[model samples]
Target: MNAPRTVVTDLPTRIRRAEPSDVGALALTGAATFLESFAGILDGRDIVEHCRLQHAPSVYADWLADDAVAAWLAETVSPPAPVGYAVIAPPKLPLDDLSETDLELKRIYLLSRFHGGGVGRELMNHAIAESRARGARRLLLGVYSGNARALAFYARNGFVKVGERRFQVGGNIYDDDVLALDLRA
Candidate 1:
């Protein structure tokens, strides 16, 4: 369960579980995608700092070390690898805080260049299937309110607004809308 396992080997961009060894690559890709996609939605300085802090090798290594999380990485080695990635956690907030059986979509991002080629959807499918397989009743995630493209993608994938919160990145605060998908429904 800890090692990378291919889910779609036929497609040039294959999907697989992320392992400890792929931590750095996963973090780098995640940060790069965030930085590129949120460029106009976020302050340039904040985006730069967020990317730098979140993609640090140590940060990725630490996340990989956590026992509560799992990630999947998509790569197209034959056609140039590093396509996208998805991270998930089982109700990361303390259990006492909420009664819902949920899986947090910590992150699901694809390189900007691969935005409309089904890569993002593929990554989302991987996360959703994995969450369902793990007995998750629902899946939750937060997306910056200003990121219209991401919001639209999630809505198209069956997610609906469930809540909202302010996320602080660098020195700026951004409103983020929480979305959820009921797996059992």
Candidate 2:
């Protein structure tokens, strides 16, 4: 009897909880997507170092150690796969001190190869669902002001401009805008 062939196209690309085995691949995917997604918007050195330091094994290990952190990694059955990932966590601040209206969409990124393929929307859907499940009434994120693509994508996903802050990376200064989405409505 012949074994059933696995069809890559039939494999679902939905987001799910990330596993330890996904560390290396996910980091690389995040780094690639960051550089490719921000090519013209950020300084080359800044991007590279950001990925190196932020996506390093230790960083992911640390993230995994956080009990409150939840991440979803996108995958397909195809060879050389893995399309994207998103991470969400409750606000690190005291909820009592702040309003009940706050949650954080920590990160959502995809490989350049998967750009404009609805992968991002799928990830956002998962994140929003998770946040809603957790009783969060709002979602917020910060993006580099120079990263127009990310800003547009966030806006398209229902986030609105809330405010701005200064961020520095690789010795380069940048202005970042804060965006938020009210989930209760």
Candidate 3:
């Protein structure tokens, strides 16, 4: 039997700056989106362990408490459920000439069910706008090499390849392409 697909476009969602009180929501959304995005590309055990530590609520609380960090959460209006999120912090990508004004787009994760309904793009726009407002002249991010959809998203948003790094997830390491966006443009 075929089930009806939910029309994400009809779902009302709002993107807002994440506060300290949103740690739990951000953590849950982050882990859920990460798992859904990488379940097929990454090992199950690694995904579970990685999410347990990296997506912990404490981690998000720390980010929210940091003046130098910024995060935004997207949530449905009626049910008040998180659908996506984005976070930016000081530049973490490997580069010899990174400036003090550069910032990193640590992540922009949206649930797969929200794909094609502009959630990802809205999250990215929030990241970019927040970065620029914070005086960042450039923005950097690392994306897994195998995520063609993510790669295309970044490319469409004016990000260009700058370098590569080995990102560790649990006990495994994967190649990631570092991309940068010139905010001065």
Candidate 4:
């Protein structure tokens, strides 16, 4: 009898709540992923300044310490690396007829290598669940209007474009599409 071959499946990446101790890694990953995704769309100086101000470890440390903010991180087991992260908090942009229970999906970014590997989906699901658990009736997010891949991903996950806003990076202004999903529906 011929020996039978065993089929193996890759283990799922781990997603968990990020802690203050993770600020350093989160900042690095945030800068790397942001540049990977948007560098071509922004000027080199703009990208550098944006990363320095927004993705600095001190900024992440502040976010991690905020009681109202929530963050989740995704990690691969094979080599043990931070592959993705998500941040959720109260909405910053004004919406007409806003509800008291609305929350914002401030950001969700993943390493390009991890794209299409279900890590983004897992991180999104975690954010949605956390928002719902905290009594949020809806979740909103702002994505770069030119980022078709992210727009499509958000759409597939129940987000619908509801408005537009200006996003500033350094001295450059870019249009962003605001998307929202009603969690109570």
Candidate 5:
């Protein structure tokens, strides 16, 4: 009898827990993705400064060592590259009646090239699961009010707008909608 032939397909992108060693890569990906997502609408200097301060390697290193924070990265297996990432941490702001079990989805950013390719969804799902595993009953995030694409994506994923806040990036202040997802339900 002839040996059976084996067929192999290209490995799909995957999501993995980010470690302290990944701080540099995460920082770079975070900053690049942020710029790709918002540069057209925001001032270049503000974006540059914000990315430097918020997505610096030192900041990621600190987060990696914090027990309250969880992070994940998405990468393609064929030709490895950090395409996206998500970060979840203890809530920085109160969510009215839902304060006790609330966790914040601090960030969920993907390279523009991977935007509609399911990477964002995978990252989001992983973040949600991680939050739940950490005892979070609700997940909250603040997104720019004018970002219709993000608003629609969050809506599709069961998040509902609960409030509004002002978000500052350098000297600019943007109106943001605070959205919440009931993980317990």
Candidate 6:
């Protein structure tokens, strides 16, 4: 007898929990997406340094080694190329006193070519499911204040503005809007 599928999600890209072995792919995609998403919106030198330091494979490896962190890597099935990813872990948002039940969607990005293809939603859904599975009562995220596309995406998914943060990218400081989703609802 054939095994029955328990889920019916039709994702545009294949996504799975990122393993230690996927550190390189994750690093590359993170850097590429970060650069593509901020090219004109941020200083060129700042973006370069930020990508070099923040998106290093060692950074991803550390995340993968952590017991509390969960990362999902999205890829093209035929070419097997990493196109996007999402990471969720214990809250580290601008909130002064976050509850233990709060989790943050630390990162979610995709190559510019993959935008509007439903892959971002799939990655987000994966993060939401993982947060719920881990007993998170709320999911939080931070997006650059000028990133209208990202803000729209988060809003469409029911995230609401809750706070603000001054985030550092390389040597520059930028404004970020913190958004939260009530998972219990």
Clashing pairs in 4: none
Better of 1 and 2 by TM-score: 1
lDDT by residue for model 6 over 1-185, one digit each (tens)? 11221332343469899999999999999999898788877999999999999999999999999999999999988668898899998888869868999999999998767777778899999999989999898999999998887899999999999999999998999999999999999
Q: What lDDT does the true structure give each of the candidates?
A: 0.78, 0.74, 0.89, 0.86, 0.84, 0.89
Q: What's the TM for model 5?
A: 0.90
- Number of the candidate with higher lDDT, 2 or 5: 5
Better of 4 and 5 by lDDT: 4
For model 3, the local distance difference test gives: 0.89
Which pairs clash inside model 1? none
Give candidate 5 misplaced runs (Cα > 4 Å): 1-11
Q: Ten-residue segment with the worst summed lDDT in candidate 4?
A: 1-10
Off by over 4 Å in 6: 1-12
Error of model 4, residue 19, in angstroms: 0.7
TM-scores for all predictions? 0.85, 0.83, 0.94, 0.91, 0.90, 0.92
Which regions of candidate 3 deviate over 4 angstroms?
1-7
How are the candidates ranked when ordered by TM-score, highest leading?
Answer: 3, 6, 4, 5, 1, 2
As for candidate 2, its clashing pairs are: none
Expressed as tens digits, the lDDT of each residue in 1-185 for candidate 2 is 11222223444566677878788867887788777666666798998878888778776666767876778888764453677888887654322333555778878987655556677888999889888888787887778776766788898989997776676656577787877888888
* Per-residue accuracy of model 5 over 1-185 as CA lDDT, tens digit each: 11222322243688899999899889999999778767778888889989989999999999999999999988878788788899998887645665767899999988766666677888999989988887888899999898877898899899999888888887798889999998888
Q: What TM-score would you give candidate 3 relative to the actual structure?
A: 0.94
Candidate 4: tens digits of C-alpha lDDT, residues 1-185: 11222322264579889999899879999999888877667887888899999999998898899998999988877777787899998898757856779889988998876777788899999999999999999999999898888998999999998888999887799899999999998
lDDT: which is higher, 1 or 3?
Answer: 3
